[model samples]
Target: MQAAPPADRRRRRADLLTHIVLILGVLLFALPVWIVLMGSTHDGAAIGRGEVPLLPGAQGLDAYRRAWTEGAVGTTRVPVALMLWNSFVMAMLIALGKIAISLTSAYAVVFFRFPGRMLAFWAIFITLMLPVEVRIFPTFKVVSDLGMVNTYAGLIIPLIASATATLLFRQFFLTIPDEFVEAAKMDGAGPLRFFRDIVLPLSRTNMAALFVILFVYGWNQYLWPLLVTTSADVETIVIGIVKMIGTESNIDWSVVMATTVLALLPPIAVVVLMQRWFVQGLTDTEK
Candidate 1:
């Protein structure tokens, strides 16, 4: 082979460095997950004794079965299946509800001129500064007063209004060409018709990306669900996992690790499935 040019050699060296760094980053993140997966396969006693198994164990199936069906021995007998279902339902509702409300809120703010529009936008923007932890008490009282505690409505409703989603949609809406609006008007489309037809189609990528993010946020919610749901029937997986680790005497590390794996899978699956749309939206928004 002919000798490579100096520039080409330097570029190749840079590429190698980049790949090495990327591999290291991947390993850094993946190692913990791998450990958890390995731990979940082993016996609870072995894990409790601080024995970290590097390989998969024969008890993998049994561990998962117990975690899914029976949960931990000393904790509440709520199955992991029920907790997963509650988490799924809560995630879907929060994602869909936030998307719907944010879209409409952004549409009104961006596309229409109304009284107190600035005021309304400011009010919503202000909420971004106040996190769930700050408002937990008042929010809980409100839900309790409404008799929504321990109900699906309590889990879903309070979390549906998201300032971040509204802001994202607002920015995305502002980027849309005015020509589309004029064209829609010339085609005799009304406001709602324009929104439903033109705006929604244009926003599909953004919506998909936001859905993945919001779904994960909802699924990972711990404090809010812990507060709202007193009944085992409405308990989310995150809370159930914590409940699994009973006092020091009864902690089942294998089952807890199995539940951890289960808890992580849905969010990972959501991101993986929406990876294309998510990347596209992010790249497009940067433009």
Candidate 2:
């Protein structure tokens, strides 16, 4: 056992300092989440009164119950529960649909080389730079043309072609040992079979990570859903929240805080549960 040289010792100290800085950065990023949790547990009055509570007291649950039942402009006066269901259903469908479509497109681009492969890849990749706001009006018209207005198709179909997911999977698939694809092909595994038996299982971590990312996207979608859905009949949780802040005077802070808390649960649970997969996906993709 020998002590490090002076130079190496200083290097180690530098690394330690880097780690300390990184930890502090992480805590700073997490502060807003902590605030949301705290705010969710308090009533509108307490929150408005600046009574900052650190923990979830019994009163917090009571406020949550009230928010869940009659949080302003929720469908059926049970905005929290109603919006939760809407958000869950929409998020799930959009996430699943985007994954399925992205996976298939990525597989095609990765495994099967075509004449215009690079062109197609570049075309889809180009959309990544174009913000949704740029083409939303045309997209709305397209959906309207297909007569999918106010329907699930209008909400989910426009989002099915996630360029980011396609790129992520394509990059991941390229890293897979080519021998696996070769072996599947030798065993008469067609494209579909190859995808089913080889690509998907190996790509589960990436898919899970992508799922969380896209689920959050769908869950927090406001503009598209608002434009497409006419009323509470098919409105999402976010839409309900906006609706709560009516044009008239006097917004109910209590109901708003309560609804906000309730709305936060699904995405928070999603991030917590799939966190390992997300980490693995990022690591694997980085490698």
Candidate 3:
């Protein structure tokens, strides 16, 4: 057989190098998750003794079962199931609420011709600089004054208005053609009908992308949830995981590992399920 040309040989070497780098990157990120998975199957004492489990243990899934039903024995006894539910509710509510508010707000800002329209848009844009951290005290005061503390309303409502989402939706809206607006008006479709019929269908992909991002944001929120919630009934999975990792003596490593695994499932499921829409929305070449 004839030997491969120099260019072909070089291309093969480059492909090999690229794959090696990709594999190494995967291992770098996945190592901790593998250790946690193996650790969760082992006895808590072994982990506490600094024994990093690299293989499966005889404990099987008991740790997970205990974690799911019993919860973090070190910090509190609220069930992992309840915490997961609370987190799901908070994330879903926040994601949906932000999308709804951002969609309408952006629609009005882009489509309407009110006085100070640009001024209103600038005002909303300016709020992006004032994140929840900066306004935590005043926001908490408002929630507290309204008797929303330790309630779902307290956890979800305060986090629902996202300037980032509004900005993204506004940018997307501006790309829509003026002809579509005029066509809808000529057809006697009111603003709401035009929005419902024309805009929403065109925005499905973007909404899916934003939903994934906002869901993860709400799911991973630590400080805000930590501050606003004092009741176990409204405790999120992230907070529960932190609570599980208390003073070393109180730490049940197996339970913590198991809880961590459980906490990761929902967000992973969402991403995996909506991956196509998420990728398309972010990297759309057509529009």
Candidate 4:
């Protein structure tokens, strides 16, 4: 048996310090989740009275039940449930559609030898510099002309083409060896076959990461849905919350917090469930 060298001992000390810092950082991030979960359960009177419940309080379910029913039953308007469905539907469409468009566009640009390829990509890329707000009026006209206003089509169609997703897939595709594409072609595989059989399977990690990112973005979309949907009939959860805040009557902080927590569940679930793929994708890129 031998004792470690002084230099090795110092390295161990540094590693211990690093672990401590990382643990503290994680706790810092987790604190808000803790507060929200606790606060959502407390009644408005209790919460306002500063009687914070560190755990599930006796009245927790009561508050949650009220929030879900919007403080009444058989009202024909469960805004919480309706908004949840709306957000999920819109987010899923945006995620799937964006991935489809990105894969197709990236495959063409990276693997094919086509004329005006750069020009075509550049034209799309240029739009990335401009935020959606800049083009909203024109987009509104298109949606309105198609009679898609206050409809799911209006909510999802305009978000189908994601420049960020395309760029991410393009960069990932570049890292892939060219030999795969050449071999696929040699096997009499056409462009579509090559992409489907070869490229997509290998690009799963990137696609998963991109899907999660796009899903989060779509879930948090407030502006586009707000402007497009004129009535509560079509309002997404984000818009619903904003409307809740602007109600002319007294504000119910407890109900508001409860709704906010419910709204956060989907995005939180998305990140947690896709965490493995997200980490794997980053690791692959590093390699």
Candidate maximizing TM-score: 3
lDDT tens per residue, model 3, 180-212? 999999999999999999999989999999999
Model 2 local distance difference test score: 0.80
TM-score of each: 0.95, 0.82, 0.97, 0.87
Q: Cα-based RMSD of the predictions, in order?
A: 1.6, 3.7, 1.1, 3.1
lDDT of 1 by residue, 101-196 (tens): 999999999999889997999999999898678999999999999999999999999999999999999999999989998999899999999999
Q: Please list all clashing residue pairs in model 2, or write none if there are none.
A: none
Off by over 4 Å in 1: 1-3, 285-287
Top-down TM-score ranking:
3, 1, 4, 2
Off by over 4 Å in 4: 1-13, 48-55, 71-77, 285-287
85-135 per-residue lDDT for model 4 (tens digits) = 989999999999999998999878888788999888887789899988899
Residues 46-128, candidate 2: write the lDDT tens digits. Answer: 66576766676455566567767666643345457867887788899999999998898888898887899979988999999
Whole-model Cα lDDT per candidate? 0.92, 0.80, 0.92, 0.81
Clashing pairs in 4: none
